[model samples]
Target chain A: MVSVAFKKNLKEKYGIEFNNEDLLERAFTHSSYANEHHGKHNYEKLEFLGDAVLELAISDYLYRNYPKLNEGQLTRMRSNIVRTEGFSEFAKEVGFQNEIYLGNGEEKSGARNRKTLLEDVFEAFNGALFLDQGMSAVQRFLKQTVYPLIDEGDFDASRDYKTELQEKLQINGAIDIKYEVIAEDESVPTFTVQLLVNNQKVATGTGRNKKAAEQQAAAKALKK
Target chain B: MVSVAFKKNLKEKYGIEFNNEDLLERAFTHSSYANEHHGKHNYEKLEFLGDAVLELAISDYLYRNYPKLNEGQLTRMRSNIVRTEGFSEFAKEVGFQNEIYLGNGEEKSGARNRKTLLEDVFEAFNGALFLDQGMSAVQRFLKQTVYPLIDEGDFDASRDYKTELQEKLQINGAIDIKYEVIAEDESVPTFTVQLLVNNQKVATGTGRNKKAAEQQAAAKALKK
Candidate 1:
């Protein structure tokens, strides 16, 4: 049985009242708890949906706010903002640990403090919010909570492999840099990329796809 | 240089004129073309973002429209709608083959007609839409175009793996069915799941995550 006081506390903390209290309850209910409660409640499905909703909300915020930023910069920023560490921290800040329902085993193991568990629960909560309300509500919640963490000014702060390779080659007086997919294996569907600096093969790398292989080759070139 | 007539035709077909011509140009410009055109234009970055955006849009639509549908069903529906065959057909219908910019080699090889290429370009176009008009516009376009195709009773017409598995088990007089993640491998970060019918293992499968493993198990159970 879910506590009415718990529901009230969550509403107060989030500053939003839920019409379907069961949605909120479902968000907080962990798989361990669901197992213990004989499959009465679980956050698994909600977490799946929430993960998608969270990605969209974050992507939308980034796209709208940063008009001048390139795809690579936006991707890195998005990754930083949405990673498990960030979600876990946000969950702790929002007092999700106290609200989460865990089985006796999970409680004894301190599962609420686990970063992956908390992150999954946070995603599940977002999913529940989207299901209960709509995209608009989820977007508003993301804008209010998560959007502020990303700094547009720090877009080019990190040295990506491609950038690093270009810089390294330029310093060494290499005029032109080129990446070519040299070979593709059909069995594993792996692509082999060759990095050329001034018509000379500088490095080679393989990956599951061309972009990944190119990144790897660039990383290798940077190292050399 | 991209042909002006080609661009105009695309504008008429897509029903949205581009705010940034560069975005549209980039959407049509393949990596092969970019390689030939001094790397000034390409669809790789757009394709990455588009993939995420497409997944989110489809997931959101499925969650909202199907209240009784589970995560696996939603995922399968998304995959079916976004797969190479689906995208290839959609791309052909939308005149993407005519609009795409390809290198001489790619053009000679009929890359525009290739299923993988069509899928990539379609996703790249999605990225272009997101960049040019913002998330709202992209969301609207996705809801209008892609959502209808999924919701038009054709997608729901097919029997799903879970449903088949359930029906089969019921017919076989197996009163109890359960999916359990029996093992977790830290090396590959994979989970091994087993489908149990009447307290006996009916099928076993492994995947990168527990949900995937469970789905695989269900799929195997259906095959059995």
Candidate 2:
């Protein structure tokens, strides 16, 4: 049973006052908990929904706020903010560890303290929060959590590998730097960009987009 | 210059009447097109936003319509529906090839007709549409295009690997099966699940999530 104090604490911490207490409860209910309790619906579905909502909110914020950053930079920044480590960190800050409802086995194994599971439930909580309160609620949650981090240049201070690599190679006199897109494979289907220096291919990297691949390739080249 | 005729046609064809005509213009403007035009924003930013919007819409639909399907199946189905092939197909149906603005070079080289470009423009259009008209309008576009395809079992029929792999190994009588998470590399940082049969590891596969990794592992094992 979810305590009223927990709900009140959530409201105080995140300003996320849920109208649907059941949805809020469902968000914290892990799959193992659901399975052990005879096929009850778990947070997986909510996680799916919340994952999308979280992405859109974050993407929208990045697009609106970061005018100078190209799509690739925006994407990488979003990835940095929303990826597993970042999410788990945010989830921990949101104080979900004590609130997550785990099955007996998972509880015995200390699954509530698990990093991956912690990240997952935040996404699920956002999803459940989205269902109960809608996108604005999720947006509000992000505004409080993700936006501040972005504003503080937390994800922005990462190395510009392509710039670094280009500068390094320029000492050998000016050479042609071309990044070409290799034919994409259908499995996960990301674009692979190969870095060609003076018409000789140095390294290749894959990403969901071209610039990201080029950056990775540049990083690989620098390493070499 | 975006013609009024194109806007009228979009209204008639896809039922997308834009409140912001500039956004409509921006949506069709490719990166190459923007580069040639001098400081004009391209569709990439919108594509980023729209990509997330399109995903959330498709994800929301899949979640609601297919309750029995787990998050893994829901994700695969969404991927199939919103992937490059599907986006290009839907974009072609909406007559974007004729309307898309390519740069002089791209126009001469037939980049407008390119499969990947076609896919990209639709995603950008959705992003622009999402910004102007919001999620409901985007959902309407998907309903006319993506939802129908989903209903027709277009993405439903796929090879069931786990079942096939199980049956194949069962011919030898009782076999031990285990899928283990070997090591998670934070670079791409997806769960890498390794399949084991009779305590011997067979194949490993990676995914953004566990179930997807397991599916890929199963698929690999089936092939073996």
Residue range with the least summed lDDT across 10 consecutive positions in model 2 chain B: B182-191
Q: Given candidate 2, what's the lDDT at residue B122? A: 88
lDDT of 1 by residue, B118-210 (tens): 888888888788778766677676665566556654355254566677886688575898888889874445679898877998999786445
Q: How well is candidate 2 docked (DockQ)?
A: 0.56
User: lDDT values of the candidates?
Assistant: 0.73, 0.80
Badly placed stretches (over 4 Å) of model 1 are: A1-22, A32-41, A61-83, A131-149, A152-224, B1-22, B32-41, B131-224
For model 2 the local lDDT of residue A27 reads 82
Of the native A-B interface contacts, what share survives in model 1? 0.44
Considering chain A alone, what is the TM-score of candidate 2?
0.68
RMSD of 2: 15.7
| Model 1: lDDT of residue B50 | 81
